[model samples]
Target: MSSHAPDQARVIPLRPVPTEPTEPTPKEPLWRDVVGDVLRRERLAQERTLKDVADSARISMPYLSELERGRKEASSEVLAAAAHALGLGLADLLALAHGRLAQPTRPARPLRSRIAPRPTETQSRPGDVRLAA
Candidate 1:
């Protein structure tokens, strides 16, 4: 009886399996820290320190530090001046701040007004009695 296996274990050329190149995953958007992070990065890129920007923006160093650290919320005026010091438009800064701040906007309640009751048919059409049809 012949065992019907490969006569010489049929030589099979083992090819190397191809592998896919891996890319780094993109970072998630930071909606909450966008404003502070943008400001800090831009300042650093422009080679300006917090103290320098604070002096130019006419704000306290501690307050500006807080703003850059995302620990403090700034008023519109302060934000405007800070943007100016950073050579950016007030509108741009405001847009960045708006993107970060959460607006508590709830839908308005429906309006309901009390209306006077209508008079009965007898009262409206005096002396008229109609038969049921």
Candidate 2:
């Protein structure tokens, strides 16, 4: 009964406060892009064209070009064929990709992995079905 006036409610802000800027984080490269780089590098090193490699691999030039441009995700068979066409084994191709992934182009780590990482403690992931070979 002695108060001069009732307290008014303050408005809450919808936006969050800005923080200090930090170094930008690097993103993980896609598997297709990594593989495509290897393929293109090898082909160019050997002085070959897309049509030549595609012909030897028994795939359409457009398809091989797409693969080299990372526009498509090649199957195991197609990858093997392309590798063989380039005088490289499937293992060699994969090794090149692994090396590329291990290289550090930026200071920050990738948010997600582009390839299978080293073994870790078994943890169940959604839609993951382990198969014993």
Candidate 3:
């Protein structure tokens, strides 16, 4: 029989352990994807057709379509031509892509300390080797 009363006895509730907030690995956006997305968005906002933009940019319609779908990486000259056709400069296009990349969907992680922790005694000594008898 317990001597302590129910009120006085210690009671530990079963609760989930609090853990560090884990963020899923963010996928790095490819340059082609960023460029294609910006180009598509700009074209759509202007209510322009693929053919019109391609023709004005002096590029093939198929190639422009591929670029818009992020299936093809465009050369700097092609990007410049497309940007010019859309009344934007290469810098403007790159800036738009940079902006998209800069926006974060999750909280930024804290930077880790540059200095590593000292090894514990359990860790093997440097250059120490043992052979079985």
Candidate 4:
């Protein structure tokens, strides 16, 4: 009979895995989406069509449509053109989008203390190290 086995198991050290927070943070809306929403909303409020706005803005209908759908990111000039077409200045357009972003998507979370809570009397045990505040 022949048996071969390692005298001791090998140990490998690795970085500790990161743990997720107990409460998942809400995702923030993309800037493109926010801007697109503002443009589309303003145009609709003015009872205008995509083609009409595109022509006024001097941009291709397809490009304007893509911007409205949040399918493409527009340059500052393009955004300004679109805003002008909708009878809005660039600042006005940005303010509208900012309003949308400022609106909260989720209910407010309860405030959490920044400091770690100390062990309660019931949780204290022999050989435990207690730190003074």
Candidate 5:
């Protein structure tokens, strides 16, 4: 009975085990992602149809849709045309993109804990100025 119990306790491995632990790679946002987000946000805020913008920009609806979805990398001229169609200059589009990139982000916390003041505020200097002259 003792020998049978010892044999039953031994388990056979069914799959190969990794010798080392693997680290997950962090994902970085692509330029297309940033630009697409800005464009989509602006379009939705203005309550304009994709077809209207595409016609105004002189680009095909499908192409414009692809661009807005970040599936295509548009040329400078195309981007300018699209910006113009949306009543925004190339500079304004780029500025909005830069602003999106400049936004501060933090790891998500529970709602209760998130209500607490941020650590940066406590450690910030009194005269710290963010604006450029």
Candidate 6:
């Protein structure tokens, strides 16, 4: 007689193997691509040429061209000035930049309760205590 348990063979279930080949999904569009599209559209809508926008924005024409073509990424300050030259607000520009960034949204927090320290001792109120040297 065999020594193996009678229930052991019946108890364990078999796992199914995949029959089809798995394929990866295409990558999402880049931030530069989105920003480039926005910049191109805005400039076109205003009937402004690339040279005109670059000149008005006080940025180099080639650099602006690169930015518009998604070959370069722009910093916030640069984007703000560009937006301003396009008659857009800084906040609006920031929103556009965020859309290009496409980061996941985190929940907002309440305003900070702490106050910032003054640069100079004189800036502090007369009633405030002086710290030890």
- Measured by TM-score, the strongest candidate is 3
Candidate 1 vs candidate 4: the TM-score winner is 4
| RMSD score of candidate 1 (Å) | 28.6
* Reference-based lDDT, residue 85, model 5: 89
- Writing each residue's lDDT as its tens digit, candidate 6 over 1-133 gives 3344644331211333333443453466777777777787788899999889888889998988898888998997777777777888768765776776675444333323222332465444454444433
What TM-score would each prediction reach against the true structure? 0.48, 0.64, 0.69, 0.68, 0.59, 0.54
In model 6, what is the error at residue 122, expressed in angstroms? 73
| Model 4 misplaced regions, further than 4 Å | 1-21, 110-133
lDDT of 5 by residue, 31-108 (tens): 777777888788888999999999999999899888888898888888888889899999999999889877756454
Which digits, one per residue and each the tens of the lDDT, describe model 3 over residues 78-130?
99999999999999999999998898967765544322344455554444343
As for candidate 6, its clashing pairs are none
- Expressed as tens digits, the lDDT of each residue in 1-133 for candidate 2 is 3222335332323433324444555778999999999999999999999999999999999999999899999999999999999999999999999999999886654434333343344443344444433
Q: Report every candidate's CA lDDT.
A: 0.67, 0.82, 0.82, 0.81, 0.74, 0.68
**lDDT minimum window of 10 residues, candidate 2:** 2-11
Task: List ranges where model 1 is wrong by over 4 Å.
Answer: 1-32, 95-133
Query: TM-score of model 3 relative to the true fold?
Result: 0.69
What lDDT tens digits, residue by residue, belong to model 4 across residues 33-122?
Answer: 999989999999999999999999999999998998899999999999999999999999999999999998877844443223444566
The pairs that clash in candidate 4 are: none
lDDT of 4 at 124: 44
Superposed by TM-score, candidate 4 places the C-alpha of residue 96 at a distance from the truth, in angstroms, of 0.2
Q: In candidate 6, which residue ranges exceed 4 Å CA deviation?
A: 1-23, 96-133
Candidate 4 local distance difference test against the native: 0.81
Model 5 clashing residue pairs (backbone)? none
